[model samples]
Each structure stands twice: as C-alpha cells, then as structure tokens.
Target chain A: MARRGSYAKGVAKREEILDAALEVIAREGFRKTSVREIATAANLSQTGLLHHFASKNELFTEILRRRDEVDAVNASTDPEARFIDTFPMIIRHNSKVPGLVQLYVSLATEAPDPEHPAHKFFTERFEGFREELVAEIQEGQRSGEFNTRLNPELAANSLLALADGLQTQWLLTPTLDMAAHIEAAIESWRSDPKP
Target chain B: MARRGSYAKGVAKREEILDAALEVIAREGFRKTSVREIATAANLSQTGLLHHFASKNELFTEILRRRDEVDAVNASTDPEARFIDTFPMIIRHNSKVPGLVQLYVSLATEAPDPEHPAHKFFTERFEGFREELVAEIQEGQRSGEFNTRLNPELAANSLLALADGLQTQWLLTPTLDMAAHIEAAIESWRSDPKP
Candidate 1:
C-alpha cells in the first residue's frame, strides 16, 4: 500500500515537472531554456529532476509527448472535424509556442541518427503522424473533396514536409503566415470546381 | 613579383581544399565527416586548412558556396531554361548527394540563430533564391505557362518550402521520389489549357 502511494506521488511529481518545463520553454525560447532553470521552476534540484528522467534527451522527448497530448486534446474536442481540418489550427497554436517548435526542429534533425536517445520517439512519431494523415487524405479523396488523382501517401508526406518546412522558415522569418500558406497549399490539392 | 605568385598559389590551394572537402562530405555524409578527415583528404594538417578558413562554420559555408557555383554552372549550361524550369533537376541532383543535403539541413536549422556564423550567408541566400524564383515565376505567368491567379511571391515561398520539407523527409526515408512530387506540384500550378 505504501509502494502504491509512493508510485502515485511520483507520477504526480513527474507531471508537475513537465508542466513547469512547458511553461518555461514557452516563455523563453528553447535555446535560452536550461534544464537547471526548469528544475528550479519545478522546485527540484538538478539531480532530483534528473532522477525522474533518464537524460536530457528523454526529458525533452517526454515534454514533446506531453505537448502532443495537449494538442490532440485541443484538436479532438471538435468531434465532427477530422485531423486535416484541425491542422492549420495546430500550426497556429505552434506559432504561439516558438520555443517548443525550436526544440522540435533541433531534435528532429538530430534524431535521424539511429543511436540518438530520442531516435525511437521521433521515428514512431513520424510514422504515426504520417499514417494518420494518410488515412485522413484517403477519406477526403473518397468524399471527392480532394483530387482523386493525388496519391494519399505522397500527399500526406508532402503536407507534413510543407508544415515542417514552413516552421523552419517561420523560425527565420517570424512574420511568415505559416497557416495561410498551408491553407493555400491545401486549396491547390482540392478537386477543381465543376465547369 | 614573388608575393603575387604566392597569393595565386594560396588561392589555388584554397580551391583544392574546398574540392577535397566536397568529395569527403559527398561520400561520408555530414554527420560522419570530420574536419580532421577533411584536412587529411586535402593533404593538409587541420591548422593548415584553418589558415584558409576563419573557422569550421566559414569552411562549411564556403563548401556550400562552391557547391552552388557548381550547381549553377550545371543549371545554366542551357541558357533557354529559367530557374523555375530547372528547379526539379536541381532537386534531383541534390538527391544524388545525401551528405551535402544533410549538411544543408543541419546548417540551415542552426543558422537561424543570429550569432551563428552562417546566419548572414543563409539570409542572403534565401533572399536571392526567392528573388530568382519570383522572377522566373513572373515570367511564366506572363508566358501563360502558369496560373495568373497564384501570387508569385507566395508560390515561390511555397516551392522553396516544399523542397526544403521534401529534403527533410528524404533524409528520414531514402526511397521518397522528391523530384516526382515536385514535378506534380509544379504541374498543379500550370494554367488550365483552353478547352
């Protein structure tokens, strides 16, 4: 009974740390946010924080996981809407969280190395995201909303790549309207209006 | 004079080092290639190579510059082609050198930091590239080769973003047909043929 109580406390503490980390990262850019700062914000020593996560990489990965959960919850609240419909909103939300976006771009570029600690996390994330996008695109095609000529897999990949690419650009040029560009690109893929 | 002769020799030596670095990076990929290995391939000590470049960032930046020169020479061999028309070919050539592509992606992501040595280089490169694309796109619009409704600036940005995004995906999944996707994307922008 004591062990179970301790386990629940540990889980609660972990959530507290993640929430603190997210607040710090969102307030300060990723490059400026340090683990020590996050730990301090969470009312833990650096070592105590490390005790919860295996390493900095694992901690950041979990932060991203937590972020995904938050985004999914926000996106899914509209039960009638599909993933594609909410993509632009997600991007807009991302624009408001540049720090997290920076973390994502940096880690994604690094995670291509098979031995990187976040490698498995990113690999599975990309695969799952692509699968979800493909399924959504195929549905759009069946409904004659998207051009049937478009390959669902390729479209999914392109959309994901475009979003990633736009984020990179947005980082450099903050005023770039990423969501608008995404909307325009999606419009290009829509089936041509009847003559 | 002797001084002039030595200056000429120094310039030649710099070219030789860049060529060697390019060869090494093309074969080994950006992550696996090291400065020492590049120095060895150029038949120079690391210090000797550093004499020609202010730092590793400058050296890699020069390598990219050299690559752009080489690509431009290839891309412009046929004077009739505009930049937009030749873009898919450039993407195809990029696919052949995954190492350089990886280097480009890594450096681009890093260069967003204002303090990064390559920041100015990328800023200018993006601006120049965008201007060239916009000019070519405007020319196509005038020729009725592209839809007049599409904003040239947005289209240029979209194309650049798509290419950058596709490169990111290609790094993760090697079998992706980036050029084919690019071709299809360009096709989508073409003006509808009169019935």
Candidate 2:
C-alpha cells in the first residue's frame, strides 16, 4: 500500500542520514560538519535533508540518542560488576566508533554553552553517572573487597575522571595499554601503604 | 632594514593568524576549522598563510605550543608548588577566560591524537606532571598529613584525572564549586565506612 511504502522510505531516510552524519563528522570534525554535506553524503538534496530533521541540533540529538541506546543495552547486560569491567566496555566501544568518539570529546567541550543541547545531557549524565558509580563502589565495600576507609563518592569521581582522562591520552597513542593502565589504577587502590 | 621590517610584519601576521584560528575554532568545531578561513580572518591571502606554516598540522601544533607556554607561565612562578597550587590556579584562571577553558576541554579530547602536535607535549606533560603530583602525595604521606595507606602513584594519577575531569565539567557549568570539589576529593582519602 502507499502507507507501507512511505513508512519504509522514512526509515531508510533516517538511517541514511545518520550514516551520512557519521561520515561527515569523521571527515570534517563535529563543528565544521554542515547539514549540507551530510545531505550530499546521504545522496539527498539539502531540502530533502531539511525535510527529515527540523534543525541541525535535532540531528545531533538523534545521534546522541542512538548512542545512549547502545550504551543502555550494553550497560544493562552486566548490571552488577566491578568498575573494572564497565570501564573497559566504555573504552572498547569508544575505539570502535572514532567519529562518535570525536563527537563526544568535541561536544564535551561545547557542552558548557548554555544553548547547546548537550549541556543538559552532560549535567544529568555526570550527576547520574556518579551516583551509579558510587553505588558500584559501595557494592565492593559490602563484599569487603575494597578498603573500608575510602570514600565511595570521591573514589567514584576520581575513577571516572581517570578513565576519561586516560582515554584522552590513549586516543593519541592507540597502542597504549588501557586495560593495563586501569589495572595499575586498581592496583593503587589495592596496595595498602606501608603502615 | 628589510630583515627587521619582515620580522615585525611576520610577528604581526602570526598574531593575526592565531586570532583567526581561535575565532574559527570557537565558531566551528576544530576539524571544521579551515586553513582558508584562518588565512582570511588574518586578512591574509592563502599564500600569505602558507608562508607562515607549511600545513594545517603545523598551525595546530603552534596553537598547542602557545597554550602550553601560557600554562607554563601561569605555573612558572612556583613550579615546585605547582602540583598543589595548579588545582586552585585552574579554578581561578578558568573563570577569567571561558573561551580558553572550552578550548582546553575540546582539545583535551583531540590532544590524544598522536598525529596532533600536542600529543607528545601532553604525554610528556602528564609524565612530568604526574611525577610532581606523586612527590606531593609522598610528602603528604611523610608529613602524616595524608593517609599512610595511600598509593602515591595511584593517588597522583587519580588526582590529575579528577582535576582534568572536574575542570571539563566546570567549564560547562561555571557555577560549580571547583575548589570545594578538589578539597572533597582530597578529603575522601579518609572517611571510614560504617560497620
């Protein structure tokens, strides 16, 4: 029927546009990426691109939403685990999609702009991410696997920061042993100082 | 006389080019930032821009070098105390220049690219930075100001990560109590869990 054809076409257009955005972002960088170029990459006219999304910001939000969906699926799988496991997934996923990774890094800087959609996302992300992380640490505390004196919230923040910062370094040096580096971080936590 | 004239002109041209780069980076993200626009922004023809730097990579590197120099100067007055003082300095300085702060967060993500000139600079920067941080923690441990159980290297890494991560977040949310965040992180080394 006509309705079925239109629905399929709509789905195809949505995917094609995303694929184009991913390519454009990777080639041109996040800020320089124009919808025109994305339209070109998608084999659609600029008007056609416009027909799909209301604005560039909307397109970007869709990209972020898709990314979050993927993370949700991955994160939900192993709801219970040491941060050691979860941290690696983040790094691993990041490596696979360099364009998205660059977008994240680049957008993270722009997140400070009050008008940017990502600003709210990051604020909520940071607050929620920290709470979730601290809960994990507490789980470790419950099992007596971690030092009882370490503050969970502080430890969570530090660990998140370390993981993110280390990735920045690793992006420059792909060969950098991220897992090993994290292991070293965990070792530091495990090593009781000379009393 | 010709040499002197050229030198002054070159210096002015370089400054002009830098101004353009900053503007473009602020307007468009890093990758989208074009050499052509930078040249135009500086009121120079493409050839004029090429005369100063062979390629875009060089220009990017120079920008990073300049930033490093600025940071060095900021911390130069007390390089030895920078480990402890840098955190507070970052908090204070960031409020004054929001653009530079955003630039840093964005570049921090991009800086990891080995091909980026800032790669080795940041790598070596962190190594040296870490050494200083470790020394501070060790001194704290020795002075009985910090928990003797703290692993100096791990603590140092975590601290640096926390500082970087917190700085990125604060850039987006300027209202954050940066100094308080730092102090809380430091204080977390203690705070025994409930039985």
Candidate 3:
C-alpha cells in the first residue's frame, strides 16, 4: 500500500514538472529555455528534476508525447467522427494553449533534419496524421458528406496545412480569430467543386 | 584599374560564400551548421568569410533577405497579376529549392519571439505579405476574378497559411505535390460561399 502511494506521488510530481516545463518553453521558446529554469519553475532542485527526467531532451520529448496522447484522445472520442470534422475543434483547443502550439511549430520546423532528436517523431506524426485524414476524407466522400469531386489525398493535405498555418499566424498575430478562419476553409472544402 | 578588379572579385567571392552557406544550412540546420563550416565550404578562410559577414546571424539574415528579394521579383513579374494567382507558380519554384524552404521554415518558427534576431523581419514580412495579399484579393473582387462575398483579410490570411503549412509538410515529405494542393485551396476560396 505504501509503494502504491509513493508511485502515485511520483506520477503527480512528474506532471507538475511537465506543467512547469511547458510554461517555461511556451514563454521562453525551446532554444532559450533551460532545464534549470524549468526545475526552478517547478519548485524542484535541478537534481530532483533530473531524477524525473534524465535530460532536457528527454523532458521535451515527454512533453511532446503527452501532447500527442491528449490529441489522440480528443480525436478518438467519437469513433464514428470523421477526422476532418474534428479539426476546427482541435484548432480551437490549440488556440487555448499557445505554448504547446509554439513548441510544436518551433520543434517541428527544427526536426526536419534527419539528425534532430524529434525528427522521427515528427515524420511519423505527419505520415500517420496524413493517412488518417485521407481515410477520413475518403469515408466522407463515400457518405456524401464531402464533395466527391475533390481528391481525398489533396484535400486532406490542404486541411492539415490550413490548420498548421493558421496556428502559426495566430501565434504571430493573436487577434486573428483562428477558429473562424479554419471553419471557413472547412466550409469551402465541403462545398467547392474540383478546380 | 587594380582597385576596380579587386572590388569585382570581392562581389564574386560574396556570392560564392552565400551559395556555400545555403548549401551547408540546407544540409545541416541553422543550429548545427557553423560559420567555420560555411567558410570551409566557401573555400575561404574564416577571416575571409568574416570580412563579408560579421557573424552567423548576419549571414543568415542576408540569406533570408536574398530569398525574399527573389520571391518578390518572382511575385511581381506581371504588375497586373493578382497576387493569389502567382502562388502556385511560386510554390512550384520553391519545390526546386528545398534547402531555402527548410531554412525559411526553421527560422520563421524560431522568429516568433520578440527577442529573436529575425523577429522583426518575420513580423514585417507576414504583415506586408498579408497586406499585399489583401490588396490583391480586393482587386480580384472588383475585377470579378474572386468571389466578392469573401472577407479579403480572412481569405488572404488563409491563403498565406496554406502556403506556409504546405511548405512545412513538403519539407517533411519531399514527395508531396505542394503546388497542386495550393491551387485546389485557392480554387475553393474563389468559388465557395461563406459558411
């Protein structure tokens, strides 16, 4: 019973540290933020933080993993929900968490190099996300929810790009009202004929 | 006569160094690629490279500036061309230069911070680009080339986002057909009713 209690405490501490790290990274960006600063923010000694996360890279990777997990959960809530239908909601949720979005954009841009630590993660993320989106679009077309004239693969890529691009613009210009723009794009996708 | 020849040689050397720096940055990212590597790749001594570029940041800024200049020239060829009409061609051109595209994406992601060296450049670039796009859209509407019902600002922002997002995805997956996807999005914008 004592072991279980301690394990639960450890999990709580880890979550606290991740929260602090997210704030620091969001405020200071990944390149400028340091592990020591994250440690201090979490009210833990650097050694204590190290105990939970072996290195800054490990901590950063964990944060990304957790974000992906959350996104996966949100995306899967309705097994019957088409992925395209949920994108605007996801973008709306993302607007509420600017720091996570910043981290994603910054790291994703940096991770294109084959040697970057997050390279494989981002590559696989895009490939998997693209595939899932393509399948969803195909399903929508079959069900007549989406225009059959549009190429599913191309439409899927455009939707993903629009979401990412809007997040970036919103980050740069916070007053941009990202959700509305995304909704507009989605609306167009649903109604427009092939060009 | 000797001084004139030396000045011409210097100009040639500067272009050569920029080319090498672009190659190095494209191969490794901005963070990992060093001034020393750039100097070596340019076949110049570190001192020689410094004589042209005071630091890596300066060199990077210059590279970005040059790319922008090229983009501006390409985007402005037909004075009467609607800005949105040229996007597909620009994207087609971008596909031929993955290195520059990668550099732009990586740096633009990092430049969101007010303190980042490229922060002003990116902010101004987006603002200026967005304004130009808005103007172009307005012109298109007046000329009946674009849907008059669309908000020029929203439509312009969406188009820019689509371009940036497509570039990021293209960098991640070189096989993606970026120009075609962008064209489709633009087509939708021109025909779809507001949702």
Candidate 4:
C-alpha cells in the first residue's frame, strides 16, 4: 500500500511539473525558456526534474501531450463542438502561445527522422488527426455543411496542411492572421456546389 | 588584369562548390549529409569551402537559391510556362530531392527568428513567391483558366501554404503524393463556376 502511494505521488509531481512548464513556456517563449527555468517554476531541483523524464526530447514531447490534453478539456466544455468548429479556436489559442508554437515547429522539423525520439509521437499524432478530420468531414458532408463532391481524405489532408503551413508563416509575420486565412479556406469549401 | 582574373576564378570556384553540394545532398538525405562530406565531394577542405560562404546558414541558403535558379532555367526551357503551370513540375522535382526538402524545412523553422541568418532570405522569398503567384493567378483568371471569382491573393497564399505543408507531410511519409494533392487543389479552382 505504501509503494502504491509513492507511485501516485510521483505521477502527481510529474503533472505539476508539466503544468508549470506549460505556463512558463507560454509566457517566456520556448526559445528563451530552459529546463532549469521549468524546474525552478515547479519548485523542484534540476536533478529532481530530470528524474521524471528520460531525455530532453521525451520531456518536450510530454509537454506537447499535456497541451493536447488541456485543449481537449477546453473542447469538451462545448458539448456540441465538432472537430471543424474547434479549429479556429485552437489556432487562436496557439497564437497567444508563441513559445509553444515555436517548440512545435522546431520539434516537428526534427521528428521526421525515424531515429528522433519524437518520431513515434508525431507519426501517431498525424494519423490520429487525419482520421478525426476525415470522419468529421464526412459527417459535415452528410449534413450539407460541406461540399459532398469533395474527397474527405483529400480535404482533411489539405486542412491539416493549411494549419501547419500557416503557423510557420504566421510565426515569421505575426500580423498575417492565420485564423482568418484558415477560416477563409474552410468557407471556400462550403460555398462549393452541393452534390 | 591579374585582380580581375583572380576574382573570376573565385566566382567559378564558388559555383563549382555549390553544384557539388547540391548533387551530394540530392543523393544523400540532409540529416545524413555532412559539411565534411560535401567538402570532400567538391575536392576542397572543409575550411576552404567555408571560406566561400559566411556561415553554414548562408551556405544552405545559397544552396536553395541555386536550386531556384536552376528551376527557373528549366522553366524557361518551356517558353510558354506560367508560374501555375510549373508548380506540378516543381513539386515533382522536389520529390526526387528529399535532402533539399529536409534542409528547407529545418532552415525555415529556424528562420522565424529575426536574428537567424536565413531570416532575410525567407522573408524576401515568401514575399516574392506570393507576388509571383498572385500575378500568375490573375493572369490565369483573365485567360479563363481559373475561377474568376476567386481572390488572387487568397489563392496564392493557399497554394503556397499547401506546397509548404505538403512538403513536411511528404517528408514524414514518403508515400504521400504531394504533387497530386496540389494538382487537385488547382483543378478545383479551375472547375469552379465562371464569374
């Protein structure tokens, strides 16, 4: 019973660290933030923080995972929210967290290599994102919210690509209005002739 | 006369080095290709090769610039080719050069920082690309090759975003047919009701 209690405490501490890390990154920007800063924010020694993660890549990946979890929670707050509906909200949220966006772009660039620690996480994430989009797009088509003539798989891929591509551009030029560009793209599809 | 000859020689040597680097990178993936390996292929010592460029970032940026020049030359070979017309060829060509694609993504991710050496190159590149695309799209609309109602600026941004986004996805999953996806996107605009 005592051992199980210690494991539970460990998990709690890890979550606390991740929350602190997220807060720090969102505020200070990822490039300017370091592990030491995150550890200090979490009220743990650098060594103590290191004990929770296997490597820097693993820790960074977990930070992203934690972010997704937080976004999911926010998404659930809207019971009727569909995947397509939440896209603009997510992009707007991302704009406010430039540090996290920087971290995502940097990590994604490295994640393509099979040997990179984040490779598996990214591969699975892409697959899952694409699947969710495809399902939602099909549902939208059935309800006449989208053009039924469009290919769901292709549309999903294009939407995902637009989001990813716009982030990079928006990072370079903060005034670009990524959310607007994306919304326009989505609206264009809706205006297409219905099957 | 001696000074002029030496300057010409320097220019010739730099071009030779860039040509060799491009060939080597195209054959070996960017992550696996090293400066030392590139230097060896050019028959120059690493230091000697570095002397021709300001830094690694500069060298890589120049390599990409060289690629654009080569592509332009290829496009000019077909005198009637418009910017939109050559997009598929560009994408198809990119598919055959994964190393360059990797290098581009990695550098672009870094280039968002104003202090990054490649920052200016990317800013100008994006602006120039968008301008060219907008012009070509407008021309297409005039010629009845595109949807007249579609906004040229928005279409250009979407096309550029699609190309950038698709490259990252294709890098992650080599089996993805980026060229086809882009072609379909362009075709959709073409099929839209004429204004």
Candidate 5:
C-alpha cells in the first residue's frame, strides 16, 4: 500500500499537472500544443509529465474528467432548488476557466469519432445532462412551478443544446452573459404553460 | 484577365476537390488528412491540387464559406416559407455530411481565437444568420403570424444556441431525431409570442 504522505503528494501533483494542461490547451489548442509544452507549464520535465499521463490523450481525457469536478462544485445537491439559483456560479467559473471551456469545445467537435476517447465523454455528458434536466422539469411541473404542456424530454434536450451552443459564443465574445441567456430561456419556457 | 478555360477548369476542380475532401475527412480527421490524401482521392497529385487551390486553407475556407449556400439558395427563391422547412433540412444535411458536420464543429469552436483564419468567417456567418432570423421573425409579426411580444433578437440567438447544443447531442447519439427537436423549438416560438 502507498503511504498516506506519498498519496497526498501524488494527488497534488496530478491536480497541478491538470491545471497546467488546461491552461496550455486553452491557449495553444490541441493540434498546436504539445505534451512538452504542457509539462513546461506545470514546471515539470517532459519525462516527469509522462510518468503521470502516458499520452496526450490520457492527460486530455483526465482534464475532461476534472472539468466535471469543476462542474460539481457548483452543482446543487438538493435537486429541489430551482435551476435558476443553481448554475450562475457554473457560468461564472466557466468564464474564469476559459481553458476548460475551450477544451470542452475542441474535444466536443473532434471527439465524435468512435475511436476518440472524448467521443464517449461528450456522449455521456449530454446523456446525463439531458436526463437531469428532464427529471428536474418534470419535478417542476408536479410542484406547480413549470408548465405541464412543456414536454420535459424535448425541452431538456433543447436546453442542453442551447447550453452547448452558448458555450461557443461565450468562448468567442466572452461578454455575452451565458447564464443570463439561460435565464432568458427559462423565462421564455415558463411563459407558456399547458392547462 | 484570367482565361475563360482556366477559370472554368479551376472552378470544376475546386468542386471536385471539395467532394473528395469531404469523403476523406469523414474517414480521417483534419490533422490526419493531408493535401496528398485529398489529391489521391481526386485522382490528382500534390502539384495538380496545388495548381487549383494554391493552398489547402484556401480551398477549405471556401468550403466553410459555402456552409450557408443551401440556406441562401432556399432564401432567395422562396423567402416566404416558415423556418421549420429549412431547419430540418439543415439538420438532415448535418446527419448526411457527418464529416463536414465534424469539420464545422471543430473549426467553429477553435475559430474563436483571433489568430484563426475562420474567425472572421464565422463572425460574419453569425451576424448574417442573426440578421436573417430577426427579419424573418419581424416579418412573421407584421403579418400576424407571430406574437408582438417576442424579441426577435433574443429568440434568434436562443434558437441558434439550441441548434448548436442539440447538434452536439446528435453527434454523440446517432439515433437522435434532430429535426423533430428543432421543429418543436419552432412550435414553441409560434405557440405563444408573449412567452
């Protein structure tokens, strides 16, 4: 068994490497950026970096997984709080972590190939996000806060799509107010209810 | 002035290269894809292809620019039709030309950097699309086909965002009914203008 001290150091080094990888990827892009560049950003030797992540894909894949950790920090656990209050921080954090945002965008587009590791990442990401939104919208309907006419499944998909789309615009403009846009969508949605 | 024979040949060659490029890119991604690969697919050579394109970027840029050709084609001849007709075909084409879809996905996300050549290409693309959508919504309102309370700009942006997001999902899951989802979005806008 690994010593507790060494385990803590390993975890710290992994996170440090992830932070550096995220920044390098955001600025240089995947094609242009090299593993050595990422190592430099993390203040480690190229060989040292490889010791942690066997390849660029492994590092990139880990970065994507870490992004969920970022997502989880702001993610509400109660599941009852309105989505309104829930995700503003996610937007705020996203702006600050443009690298993560850029990586998300880059991988999402390129990862569609069945062979790409991130192909499954984004695939699962959307599925989980869609299911959550559907459940939440359904819950809202039962609680009298949402429109019964709203097809939760359809609306959920649309909402998820809009979120992905907004990420592109936000990455470009950086000032378009993503969460505000999402709130506007919710407003648009709530305006019409089935009776 | 350029000779008529050369110009015609160049135009035809450009189209041929695009067709071949699309097929090759579907099987191999942008980076793995090469001028040689495209040339081989077109039954030409490195020099022959270069004679027509000058460079791959130039050729691909035109291809990317042509993204709106279908929408433009329909718009000029039949400007009075509802968005539903166009939105579905657009999504369907995304399904058919999945590689080009992948190409657009990768390029659009990365092009946000000012250094990227396609940056201005998409900036103009979004601006033009937004303008067209706003005008359409306004026309619908003036004709009493849409509600007055609707903000055409916001709705256009939302719909555009939703389309992008939904495409990401559709890419991951081959079974998704993208057109139906887009159709539902159109209905939401038409059902209640105030919402």
Candidate 6:
C-alpha cells in the first residue's frame, strides 16, 4: 500500500491542477483552453497532469464534481434551515469567484447536447436543484413561513431560473449587483407584509 | 445596378439560407455545425452561400439581427402599451420556436467572451432589453399599474434574468409551463394585493 504522506501529496497536487484549470478556463474559455496550458500552470509536465486526469473530458468532469461538492458544503451551513434562506449568502459568495461561475455557465450551455460528456451531470444537477428548492418551498408553505397561495413548483422553478439567469448576466456585466437582485426576488415571495 | 427581380430573388435566397442554418444549428450545435452543411440544406453550393454571407460571423450577426427585428415586431402589437405587459405573450410565442431558442441560448453563453464574434451583438441586445424593461417598469409605476416601491432597475434586471433563466430550464425540460411561471412571478410584483 502507498504511504499516507504520498497519498496526501497526490491529493494536494490534484487540487493544484484543478485550480490552474479553472484559471485558464475563466480567462480563455473551454474551447480555447488547452490541457498543456493547464499542466504548465500547475507546474507539472503534460505526462504528470495526465497521470491525474487521463483526458480533457476527465479533467472537466472532476472540476464540475468538485464545484458541486463546494456548493453542497456552502448550502449545508445549517442543515435544518430552509435552502432558500441560504441562497443569497451563496450567491454573494459566488460573485467573488467569477472564474468558477464562467466555467459553470459555459459548461452548462454546452452540456445541453445529449452527446456532450457533461450532459448527464448538468441534467441531474438541474433536476436535483429544482427538486430541493421545490421541497423547501413546500416545507415553508406547510409551516406558514411562506405564502401558501403560491404554487410551490412554479416558485421553485422561477427561483432557480432567477439564480441562473442572473449569473449569466453578471458574467457579462460584472457591475451588476447579483446578490441584491436575487435577495429582492426572494423577498417578494415572503408571506409577511414588508414593513 | 441589379434589376428589381434579381434583388427580390437575392433577398428570398438569403432568407432561405438563414432558415436552413437555423435548422442545422438546432440539430447540431454551433461547434459541430459547418458551413458546408448549411449550404447543403439550403440547396446551394458553398461558394453560392459565401456570396450572401462572406463569413460565418457575418451570417450569425445577420441571424441575430433578424431575431431582434422579429422580437421588436412581436412587442409592438400595441405601441402605447408597456413592454413588460407583453413579456408573457412574447415568452409563450418563443415556446413555439425551440430551434430559435436553442440558437439564442447557445450563442448568448458563448458571447460572454469579449473575443467571441457575437459578443457585441449580445452586449447591445441585453443593454437595450434591460433599458426598455426599466423604462416600462418606470412607466407602470407612474401609471399606478405596478408597485411604486419597486426599484425599476432591479425589477428590470430580475425580469430579464427570469426570462433567460426560464428559457434555459425550458430547453432542458420542455414540459415546463414557462409562461405561467413568468406570469406568476410578475403577479408577485403587482402593487395591488391579489383578491
């Protein structure tokens, strides 16, 4: 079996590569970005980089997987809290990471093609995202924390769309106050009267 | 100078080419799509197609311009009416044209890159779209049709985001009732309490 030290080193190296890949993708876009460039940025030879990810597709998949994990961690700060309550904080946190957001928007658009490698990943991501938001809305309605008259499914879908759409627009115009817009949208859904 | 008959024929031919290009783009994404394929679909030689649009960039720009013209026409059914008031109708009309929607979503995502051919087109499109919506929201507030408390710019941004975000989601799940979701979201912004 490999020693623990080497395994830890491997994990660190992998993360370093992902960070470099994200930087390149953010600057050059996925179509123009090359694996060699990522390897160079990571301070590894092409062979060494390939050792961690056998192909470009593998590398991109891992990047997306890592992103989802990070998002899950961000969403889990309070397990018992409604997910929608945490969205503004999450969106605010996201604005600081433009490269990651660009990578996501870029991949999500391309992945709509059923043949794309990231197709299934994006499909499941949206499904799970919508399902979780819908559940949260329903739970809030049941507890009278939300407007019961609102259709949970429609609200859930709109919320998801607003989040995603704002992200796309924000990428184009960094000056946009993304979190504030999202907060305003969510605030509109509150059952309580605004003071 | 060209004769009137030949000029009309040329215009008809250009439209035919654009229609075929849209079909090809919808079937195969922009990345996988080729000019040769478009020519084949349009029943023209590649050289003949080039005579109409000197480059792929020129063709794409023309297609986007035409789409904007069509959208403007759709929104102008009642010139005196507010633009936001017609968004649901426009979005519903969009639902009938999935190919156009796919082309738009695909191009908009790619256009975030400053170097992308469609970058300027999308930038201007978003800017104009937001400006128009903001103006409409302000007008509505003035007329007491919408909540005066709503920030016109924020509401306009959110509305644009909702439209784009829903389109992306609808592309993923065609069963989604996109128009209803949009209408519901708009209803939430009404100043007058729902009876």
Ranking by TM-score: 4, 1, 5, 6, 3, 2
Residue B174 displacement in candidate 4 (angstroms): 1.3
| Pairs that clash in candidate 6 | none
Q: Number of the top candidate by DockQ?
A: 5
Runs in model 6 lying further than 4 Å from the true structure: A1-16, A23-31, A45-55, A74-78, B1-13, B23-31, B74-78
Candidate 1: tens digits of C-alpha lDDT, residues B35-153:
78889989999998999988888888888888888898887688777777788999999999999998888877877798877788777887898999888888889999999988888
Q: State the lDDT of candidate 5 residue by residue for B54-135, as single tens digits.
A: 5665666666666566445744467666554577777766776566666677677767778776777877877877788898
If ranked by lDDT, best first, what sequence of candidates would result?
A: 1, 4, 6, 3, 5, 2
Note the residue pairs that clash in candidate 4.
Answer: none
User: Candidate 5: which stretches are off by over 4 Å?
Assistant: A2-9, A22-31, A74-84, A191-195, B2-4, B23-32, B70-84, B193-195
Give the clash count for each candidate: 0, 3, 0, 0, 2, 0
Better structure of 3 and 4 per lDDT: 4
**In model 1, what lDDT does residue B46 have?**
91
TM-score (C-alpha) between model 2 and the true structure: 0.66
Taking all chains together, the TM-score of candidate 6 against the true structure is 0.84
What lDDT tens digits, residue by residue, belong to model 4 across residues B1-195? 477588888888888999998898888778745678888989988898999988877888888888888878876687777778788888988999999899888888888878877788889988998999899888888988888878888788888888888888888888888988888788877845646
- Candidate 2, residue B193: how far the Cα is off, in Å: 16
Model 3: DockQ score: 0.63
DockQ of each: 0.65, 0.40, 0.63, 0.70, 0.75, 0.68
Pick by lDDT: which candidate is best? Answer: 1
| Alpha carbon deviation, residue A76, candidate 1 (Å) | 4.6
Q: How high is the CA lDDT of each candidate model?
A: 0.85, 0.66, 0.76, 0.84, 0.73, 0.78
- The single-chain TM-score for chain B of candidate 1 is 0.94
Q: In candidate 5, what are the lDDT values of residues A1-195, reduced to their tens digit?
A: 367698788878899888777767656555446678888989998899989876777678788888687567557677566554575657666767676787777777766677887877777877787787888888778888877778998888887778888899777677777887777777765634456
Give lDDT tens digits, candidate 1, residues A32-91: 366788898788999999999988878888888888888888876877777788899999
| lDDT (tens digit, per residue) of candidate 6 on B76-191 | 67777666677788899788777677777777776777877788887888899889988877877887888887898998888888889888888777888889988887787678
Clashing pairs in model 3, backbone N/Cα/C closer than 3 A: none
How accurate locally is residue A128 in candidate 4, as Cα lDDT from 0 to 100?
A: 92
Candidate 3 segments exceeding 4 Å error: A1-16, A23-31, A43-55, A71-82, A192-195, B1-20, B23-31, B43-55, B72-82, B192-195
The estimated TM-scores of all candidates read 0.92, 0.66, 0.80, 0.93, 0.86, 0.84
